[model samples]
Target: MQPPDLLFLGFFAFCAGLIDSVVGGGGLIQIPALFNALPNALPATIFGTNKIAAISGTLSAAWSYVRRVKLPWALIIPAMLAAFVMSFTGAAIVSLIPKSIMQPVVFVLLIVMAIYTFHKKEFGLLHTHLVVGRREKLLGVLSGGAIGLYDGVFGPGTGSFLIFLFIRLFSFDFLHASAASKLVNVATNAAALLYFVPTGHVLWQIALIMAVCNIMGSLTGTRLALKHGAGFVRVLFLVLLIGLIGKMGWGMLR
Candidate 1:
């Protein structure tokens, strides 16, 4: 790619990382930007490159959250492991299914999620540990496995979905949910990369540059979210959810 293309993609990656660190829809920005920047590349290669760039920002955000936020590790750890394993399985089978069918389903889900969150009003404002012990662990596993599969197959709003699920299932506020979501996202991304890298689908040169920019953005976003707290993250989540709805709806229509 040319210098201008690289610069443009890097800027998008930065923005994606920033938004993703706060609310989990970074792919909404980064993936489309990759398609626009490298129009001639193979689709799988572009996806692989996107994953390479995304994981860096995700890990950075995860580290920052872990240091600052008191995450529910007992629940999150099991979920992360489940997500890692299921993501590999999902990636392996991604080429078998037609994405056209999945797009509409995901679009509908996003719409429902947005509406439910908006209607609830105080949904993610305060942390409430509703489930605990074995039930909590089960919920974590189920969420991680299912969402991880989706991420590996068609990964636009994996982070957002994870955050919503964490909040809905575990009664976590937006801030803690986002922090936990980052850890699971890292696992899923790494799992997908395991398949992509062995298949020679990534463009490491571009991915490395994007990763640096992504990390910078992730750090900035992490700090902001930590400072502002859950109410801020909740509002950001709704905004990103709307953006995701528009993007997915347009794709389905097209």
Candidate 2:
């Protein structure tokens, strides 16, 4: 049956796109929108629909950033590949393991990440790009794998974690970190999609509606980012990080 919520998919998609383009946490808005709107729908179907909408927004944001900013192809390509592979593995094991096991650990990590970002104040304001040797490359690959696994499993704060890693470990600023995070997010989603699509979980019709809305949201967010620059993105990033803590932590407790 066609999704009853398909009627306003376009609006949801546009909003997702815009929020994702700006700070990378559009899921905070879009995913809930899907669940609340599709309460009677299957959980897997909702997840699939969320992925479709997320992909649309992510691509739109990635394109928007690429057009306005210079991206680091060296790190982005390998990182994305690694994340994609890891996500696939994680998705494969989704039913085998209880993801609840890692919830508390991830929650602590998010707390640290958010606190560090908040205290640093000038952590990633300018383009820095620190690591150059094998250490740097190793960090990228390892980080990608770690975050990808998380994305495939839980998936709330992937963007925030990614941005923080790029900034702290790689010496990139907020804007640059965000640019790279988009590419990685895309890869992780693609990996999850591969597994999800086969299981017949995706509601393509509803997903399409959300995708369109996500796209619009992404475009608007990109424009705002371009206009306001790094500082504005930083503020939103911190806000989202805080929100993530509450969201994930609550989910774990409940």
Candidate 3:
């Protein structure tokens, strides 16, 4: 890749990490940037390379949040385990699924998420702890599996979906929900890597550079989210949702 391409991707990786640290749609920015920069590359190679950077940023953000915030591990661990297993399953079968089919589905989901979040002003403001039981654990496992599968297959708005599910289903505030999402996301990323790395699809040179930038961005975003609180995260989440909607909608149209 040329110097300009490196710079362009680095910039987008940083932006992706920043957004991802807060809400979880970093792929919406990073994936397209990868496709644009390496137009001739295999899609698997691009997705593999993306996981390298994404895992780095997500791990960084997860650590940052772990230090500053207390996460509900009881719920998170099960979700992470489910995400890891199902993510691998999804990656294994990704080739069978067509991108065209996933695009419209995700586009519509983004619109609904945006509308719901916008309509409910107090959606993620207050954190309510769910009494851990069969139902709560079941919900967590199911959501994690479904979203993990999606992340493994398409993977633009995985983080956003995780956060929203945490907030809506588990009664977590935006801050806590974001923190929880990072753990599940890490599992999904790792699971995908298990498939990608063994298949020799990753571009380490480009991925490392993007990873550094992504980590820096993730740290910055984590600090801001921790300092600003749930309201800020909620607003950022909505912004990212809108962006995801527009990006996917435009791609479908063209």
Best-fitting candidate, measured by TM-score?
Answer: 1
- lDDT of every model, 2 decimals: 0.92, 0.81, 0.92
Stretches of candidate 2 off by over 4 Å are: 1-9, 129-132
What C-alpha RMSD separates each model from the true structure?
1.3, 2.1, 1.3
Candidate 3: 10-residue stretch with minimal lDDT = 67-76
Off by over 4 Å in 1: 129-131
Q: How well is each residue in 94-159 modelled by candidate 1, as lDDT tens digits?
A: 889799889989888999999999999999899986546998999899999999899888888899
lDDT of 2 by residue, 192-237 (tens): 8887798999887667767777787888888888888889989988
Name the weakest run of 10 consecutive residues (lDDT summed) in model 2. Answer: 1-10
* Alpha-carbon shift of residue 48 in model 3 (angstroms): 0.8
Model 1 residue pairs with clashes? none
lDDT of 3 by residue, 126-164 (tens): 998678888888888999999989987878888999999
TM-score of each: 0.96, 0.92, 0.96
How many residue pairs in model 3 have overlapping backbones?
0
Model 3: residues with Cα > 4 Å off, grouped in runs? none
TM-score of 1: 0.96
